[model samples]
Target: MNEGIGTTGMAGNDHYRMTVDLNVLDHLGINLYSNIAAVLTEAVANAWDADAENVEIGIDPDGKFIEIKDDGIGMSIEDMNTKYLRVGYRRRDEDQETGRTTAKGRPVMGRKGLGKLSLFSIANTIEVHSAKNGESHGLRMTIDGIHKSVQDKEPFYSPEKLPREEIQVTNGTAILLKDIKRQRLGRGATALRKRLARRFSVVGEAHGFKILIDGHPISTADRGDLPMVQFLWSFGDEEPDLSSAGQLLEREALSDRLDAWDGDWSVTGWIGTARLPKQLDSDDAGNLNSIVVFARGRLFHENILDKLNDGRLYTKYLTGQIEADFLDADDEPDIATSDRQRVQEDDPRYVQLIAFLRKQLTQVEKRWTEWRRLHEVEKAKETSPALAEWLESLPEGFRKSAETLIAKLSALPVDQDEDRKLMYRHGILAFERMKLRGSAEELAAHVHDIDKLLAILADRDSLEASLYRDIVKSRLDAIKDFQGIADDNAKESVLQKYLFDHLWLLDPAWERATASEVMETRLTTDGVLTQDMTEKERLGRVDIAYRTMAGKHIIVELKRVKRKMKLLELQEQGQTYVDKLKKILLAQGDATPNIEVVFVLGEPIDEEGSNPERLKSSMAAISPGSRIVHYDSLIRGAQEAYSEFLKKSKQLDKLERIVDRI
Candidate 1:
């Protein structure tokens, strides 16, 4: 087959030689594109270069083939031999009369002329048919045949002639690709339309060009993100018709020109941010978090957004296009790489373009943040009237800080509106507290500091009622655990461990404190308190510990749950702790000290002669600020105190209901 096709001419008595190294096809063709969409872009670009008004693409997934037909100025026999088949053909260099544009006055997209070879990347067999000026011709090329020619060390390979009946088009060109590589067609027809729509800016009637995928003409709507655009900014004379952007378009900024190098270069096109970043994500079309760059209406770089290195929070939601035709000017050096997916980074034109885009991105980020804040504020106002009243009640300076805080919360990547509303509620609470305390300036300065903002919201006085409510809820849960342990008849040591860890159970006001470790160590040391205990007292003792909180030293004594003791015995132990702690403090140069002791026992004191009330009074007189609390009362008292706080905090109840509504 190799020898049979090696000598065949393209047409009757029309000998055409494809003079080139067969090895170059590997880099320029077979390895050029990895997907059907990328390969079809080259075909569409070729059609654009041919001044085709309408390019139709047909997908035949079942038939394992694709047909791209273009009603353009198709190549004649000699034009094919010299331009179509010739590798490294520089159309711009040869067509000096027409210059950089076609006869129809559209800038030509084909430069290196290697786009024709990209066809071989997807299909094993290719058939080309064209008609021009009352002449029709056809040729067929195969991967196997090209390989055979390469193996045979042939200088040139000729494509086999196609029968006249195979030339279906009478005024344009038709390319049929057979034996397609599997999974190259992408997700589906709709996905293909969107992908193609995003790649070219000239796929509309305004440019005298149109692309039809499976009989459906590609339109700007296929880009899929226009309706989701919340804010848009355009550069250059042409402002895109954003009416289709719908009600979501909150703002649009237009500029007449984007100049670089003293007007030696210029750019046009618009950058837009979606209402939500997820709006730009798709399983079919992939992430649209990119700023596509085009030159002469063809995609020059897939995404310069990454190259810009703008790591602002707003960049994730950005997707747009910039047309810098100067990147491909005939007067300047070609800056595009071989695949045209990127430009040479060091090129002066690209550097200046990056600079210009960075400036534009900065402006867009500023507007995007403000617009997002305004939008969130309106939504928040609509959700809760109380929140609206709260916002309006703030002074000018405080209101701005509150708005920024709410906006930052809204910008979180959380998906649910309820979660964002909850965050906004807490943010407002924190802001109000800060405002009351004259910390409005501090709130404004650290608006973006999430940790500091959280700290403010969690502060005890930020929303005192709400903070206490949360604390009450948590304490109730702990109380339940303590009751379960008592009901289970756990060991005395187990009960002691639970009580020591949760000192608040004994007294609602007591909390773990940052007491001096040295003082605590000295008080709990063996010689300090152990020397005072009798052998029988030591047998029943589980733990005796010291904690300082609320500016008072507290000593907690945990006794065996089964042990029974009198109020006189409890008063003696309490007095010992008080005297010992005072002496320790005096030895360290302190004269006076505040101290309290808590005795947690499983049973009440065994009073013999007098009633329980008389015993309690005598014990209180003996140990001043000390008390004997049974384990059951300890848990019950903690629960009742918190439950009572929850019941009485009417303001927090109202705030919680408002937040839930939001």
Candidate 2:
């Protein structure tokens, strides 16, 4: 059989063994790592491989250069030759005998034999210098699109090897990517600092590694320093010791490793977010997720996310990393990779591992759901004082985000039935904060600001209508509350006019998500929603009691009033209100409601009862389940309830007259 071909393989057959084009790393070298901080992530990963205690990456965007230096076990010439110097050649497992990995209890993270290729992805050249065991080596290589050019001789495919260079330090790894790609600043990019902060923040101060991007040191990731086996069910390392199957085996197998700080973790868990359409959540190249599987503190598998398509690891809401320290970086013989980047199904050990993972995933699912519920409560707490007072005070950024949150809440569609989008949106904030709880690291990234909200409203993500409405609603809430504070009739008139214009004044009280059957009765082509005889919804006059999930008063409206309508003849409006109250009693769900209603006028400005006949007929035409009342009656009732409104209006008028005289 040909070494390159498997069993009569055709050129297109995936079975054909082929190396990934140096172009992958080549593309990544300059394009993917174009941002200074992104390139630093690679350097940080490498430093972890070197068992570095500290690493720093710096950039001079104007100078167009980047430098990364690390204090780690620097490389010997032979080590450099077999590893760094030889592309695709790695003796990582063999190096275990050298005892570099054990002290850290983690093997090196670079195995693909090709990550260094990424250096060239962003820069034209990479200069490297290092020393170890009293020996030193330094070298430099230029990409020059060498990976792209094919040679007429020598078969045209070989990785470059740099021999030696002038050295300075006794023992350390320093790399400079000259002619580096970075975000331009000033007229070019004022955002370099922020983008850098986002990228290397994961390479935080954890374990022994301390990394910095540009001038700012990386902050700890939420889960940084989380022990490998904290709170996990433990089983002793007698892998073959379990003598039975089922629950008994599970219980018996979860014994702790003798020296495992918290005991060797035996349970492995998988948790995922729900699947949505590609339009909503794309997994395409542009949106590809890289599942970094760390073994011995190195990325053994970079894009394993594509493999977990069993619909488990790829959930949009799912967050976590697949972890196992003992599993070899090479998941082969025992595990295999298909041309599709999927895991081999028949691999027994891999299957066993996954099966074990699935079981643990069950626990993980439970944990995540618990996390989700708590998350929802936390988010709800942000809005409601009861929930707010229950939770601890938030950090500065969160407190500062109150207005944004109000805007978000205002734009939300009535939470009718199950509003998945609202839940998901709030879930994002909740999950983020929940993870941040007790996290020593302040969030390094920018909080979603008011502009971001406006941008989102402008871009119209799935929350387009609601987000926009929320923004308007937030402003309304602020003004209305203030209007009530003044308790003046003039202010009340302003508030009333605002509510009429927004139409959200009719929203369910308590701000609980609500639903209404909107029937449009346009007298013109403009398509105004009105109460017409066309009668799409079968509604009758009744009480509009609506209990709120959020506490507040429910407001209901009878679409429009008719001039000759008998029910709201101003004389009968109160009785009609009582009748509607009786009607709302019948349409009960599990939800008992808090409700109110208004008889709107067809000719709102009409005199002699504000278009009485039409109003009466419309009020009479009210849905039987609805709690309804006359528009005129409501105004009268409100004024009666708050006589202060009338007094304040008179006072304001007097004050205006006095000021005019002055």
Candidate 3:
């Protein structure tokens, strides 16, 4: 059928006609590709097939269009109608005598002749201009027009020809895309450069192929990962240059062969692990925690790392590329999926590749663990010399276990170096405590045994004193936080919340435990505990509550920082709480319930018209264990109590120094 619909001063026979099946366009173009990068890769691959030396991509954010211009042997009007516009044109079969290579002796990257259709996946309209052999042609294709043709059941669709004045480039072809599907180019040109750079292997000066975005040429550095690679391993004949790996490289295994399936299959590429998993993550270039597979210099599989199912810890920091041209060899069956983003898992070649990768990962895991362990130990020692001395003091067997523990801590994906150092400091203290308990091996095996470490901290022996030192240091930090709040003149409830959870802040000896819910409920119901406050008390008042610790009941009343109450009023408040609690305990069949009332006030008591000693004595008479403490005195007393223990506990001197450094 003659599908020509426009006259461009050329002969009617030279008009462009596309005789593609409507179903093929829907299957391979409109619904096949998913993202801009994937669709753009197809165009770049086409440029490679055309033997393009320089391909420049210009993205116009304001114009809402993308222009890809290449310098290559462009097609004339005759070649456009017979080959360029033809569907399912197999270049390999048509040019078998030339071995599917371009005039420049480079293997072509196009085979199915369907890549042009992928343009429809991203752009609603496409414009093409090309010139060669003293003749040039331009044509435009719209998705809406194709859809209309499909609805009309037309046998062929003819694209509108561009006039001679619209032909801009004279030596190569330029394709302009408009009405893009995406709302915004995610991560912008920098990210696009990195992604495109990673997809092709022959995109540098040596290969004489260049792909530029905006004005900058994409090079190996645009891959955005080699500098972070601490360890690398290469397979097959070619070993990639590691000079870009910089001084971070600790070791490398180059030119290693994958001798599988009787050596019939051949692949080339290198895999590497970064020093930290965070190094593999990028705000612009996306995650590098993958092993992308490429065939015939084009991405075949986005990532085969997940398919290998290697559950080792090293995988998070792993990334690499494997070039297996045999997967796309002309003599072999097609193993690539329809979209060409991945390979068929059921294919025997892919199955074999997975098996080989798993075996290689095992070796990588072993080496990665050992190298990380040595590196972590050195870093820990540099951060804390006392920790280094502690490690050196250990016996040969214990020292080896400690090193392994350090390695495990380093690989924990903790983002901050200071946080990691804190973990190391605590880990050493737990290790020492475990050693005294003769369970050091358990600590080494289960480094995250928080409950076991807590049990050790609860013990009060000299051997476990180092853990106590760490606990005291943490409590001191909490006190410092509380001091900041009080200095800011925070609300009474804010201070109450802090003290209710951390009873040790009041008394270092009083650790928090499960309070009797029944007693609290009874106190609330009997009006002994109330949220309501009088107008005078609303300015500031003490909230009374009780908690049980170490077989003793302690009732704490937190007063506002601005409150000023007389000692008699404080005495009366303590007496009421004591009397009500005794009645409840007596009802619960305990006549001798040991209760202590601690009144924590922001301001000192109003000891008016009475001796301070006698007023205190009378208050003590009412509640035998009652005591009034100013906020400053309470904090000072707790600090002194812990500081006294730290000074006297000479055995924890080394641990104290390590904790200080952390």
Q: Each model's TM-score?
A: 0.68, 0.40, 0.68
Better of 1 and 2 by lDDT: 1
Q: Compose the digit string of candidate 2's lDDT tens values, residues 238-302.
A: 23211111112112123222232223333232223321112212211122123334344433344
**Which pairs of residues collide in model 3?**
none
TM-score (C-alpha) between model 2 and the true structure: 0.40
Q: How well does candidate 3 score on lDDT at residue 139?
A: 97
lDDT of 3 by residue, 369-406 (tens): 67877887787788677778878889998888788787
Worst ten in a row by lDDT for model 2: 241-250
Candidate 1 — worst ten consecutive residues by lDDT sum?
527-536
lDDT, candidates in the order shown: 0.77, 0.43, 0.78
Candidate achieving the largest lDDT: 3
Candidate 3: lDDT over CA atoms? 0.78
Q: Could you arrange the candidates by lDDT from highest to lowest?
A: 3, 1, 2
**Model 1: per-residue Cα lDDT at residue 115:** 83
